[model samples]
Target: MTDQTPRLEAYQSKRSRTAVWLALGVAVITAGLVGGLLLIPRADRAEPIAVPTAFASPSAAETPAARATEAATRKVTLPAKLLSQPRLTDATLQKLADSMTLQFKDTAPETEDAVSGFYGNLAKQKLTMVIAIDAPVGNPASWASGMTHGLKTSLNAGPFHDVNPGPLGGSAKCADAKASGITIAVCLWADQETYGVLGFYYRTSASVTSDFVKARAAVELPTP
Candidate 1:
């Protein structure tokens, strides 16, 4: 039993030191594993970003080509009486139509049918002429310009300006010109299938846009 207490104390101290070192080794290994996990790329765990989409514009229904195609399918004819005037006899109308045919022969070679008439008394007379023609006009603006040019050169008319195209939706123009010593309002309208000319004797272009619109509605028979 000699010196047994020192030996027991020394052995207990050694065991305590070994336990402390084991705890430190476990903490270091855990820290290294956590650092390695943090170093991995974040893209694999993050949600994907969303992309945006675009839409297209709508198509128009009242384009010029559409209108022309619709107009080509309809019939064009003038009524027996227009602008509240008595219906002229067929012979008289035919004679006027013949004269128009001759007048427009070179100017409008596409003319297929013609109708002509006079309304009101001599003091306030008006003349209306319409021609149904074969026009394959794709652009209404250019066709209107060319028609105005023909009027200027063939009829010796002045510069023409645009007017209200009316509910029918084509092209209309008017000009003031001297014809037979009278200041006349000359109006012209052209659509896909018809060409019309109106002369308001002793009147100004400023005063006859409404009359031209009315006469156009009367003479051009559009299908429902």
Candidate 2:
């Protein structure tokens, strides 16, 4: 019989060629996958980013309410009571009123309009001067606070404590006035401004006009 080694060698060569072709196919597939990844669109491949815009600036002094409040606050005058005896003249009282930082009532009688209170002049240990306030049945604290600020400008506070909020008003009486040492209290009826002097004043006890002096009475207050 023949050795047959030559036939076996030819068969092994064919098998080696087949294995090389398979290896080449795998290499081609890997290369294609890498090329596809590189060719992908930037929009689809990249992370997203946000852009910012420029804003317009606001105008200066654009607040109207703050301006109105600033304008609304102004200088106001308050009235004071004068002595009945020893006859304090209009000129004398006017000078004192001017010096004491007082403003009289607009519709007050001519007698009261001119006569302001004296600081410390007394004949019989009784009060000779007092600041009159027109506090109605409502509150007069805002008015009082305003008055206190005004008074502090000229006079100084003393003893003889009064209610923090001069007084409360709920009556029908048209007008009421009170005067103590220097501060006066009053209360009247409500006409217009249902909550008249409501927002303006804080509740306070003041020594208002003591008309029926024999008694430390709770006098009726008038409306604004």
Candidate 3:
């Protein structure tokens, strides 16, 4: 029982210092392992798995269908004299053409390379106005149908009937329309490259079909 309190206190201090030294040694070992792992080369490390995503193909313009469309497309042209009528002189046709062009501009703002001409005798009250628009038409039949319907609506016309497209081989329709209390023979034609409308004043569709064919031939200069 000699100095038992001091001996007990000394033993406790020694245990506490030993525990702290052991904890510090473990901490240093863990830090060294972590540093070693960080020093490993990135190339040797396992790559992250890549998640697959939806793949998009090329655009329509680059496809075969687009090339075929390009091949099928052609350009059209219009001449000064759209007909061989003797009475419809160049000067008279030019004046009428200018007027029709103005009217066309007002109505069809989206038309491109548009041309218009007038034929027949105005004095006889028998005249025809030909309007041709040069552009790419994918479906000629559909275009003709739509144009015919539009013309009928604009002119307050009656039902249109199918007409022979002649040797041009596209689509055509004729309707009898009334404008200013006068009957008008309205015809529309569409091809791959162009579309046109004809207004034959004081005439019948049967009488103007041939004229329409001729006018179409004159105006539509297909690319060779």
Q: Show pairs that collide, candidate 3.
A: none
119 Cα displacement, candidate 1 (Å): 2.7
lDDT (10s digit) by residue, model 1, range 1-224: 55998898886675455334322432332232223223323332222222233332343234333444544654456676667765433344445555544544434433344555545433234444344343334444555565566445434357899999798777788987654344667777666566566666567889989988887788776557
Tell how far residue 29 is off in model 1, in angstroms. Answer: 99
Candidate 3 positional error at 115, Å? 0.3
Off by over 4 Å in 2: 1-121, 133-139, 158-224
Model 2 lDDT per residue over 28-89, tens place: 32232223323333332212222233332343332322332333222112223222323233
- Quantify all predictions' global Cα lDDT against the true fold: 0.54, 0.27, 0.59
lDDT of 1 at 111: 36
lDDT string for model 3 (47-105, tens) is: 22333344433332233223334554444454555565433544535665665556544
Pairs clashing within candidate 1: none
Best by lDDT: 3
lDDT of 3 at 201: 69
Q: RMSD for each model, in Å, please?
A: 45.7, 45.7, 40.6
Worst 10 contiguous positions by lDDT, candidate 2: 192-201
The candidate maximizing TM-score is: 3
In model 1, where do residues sit more than 4 Å from their true spots? Answer: 1-71, 87-94, 102-107, 123-134, 154-156
- Return whichever of 2 and 3 wins on lDDT: 3
Q: What is the alpha-carbon lDDT for the whole of candidate 2?
A: 0.27
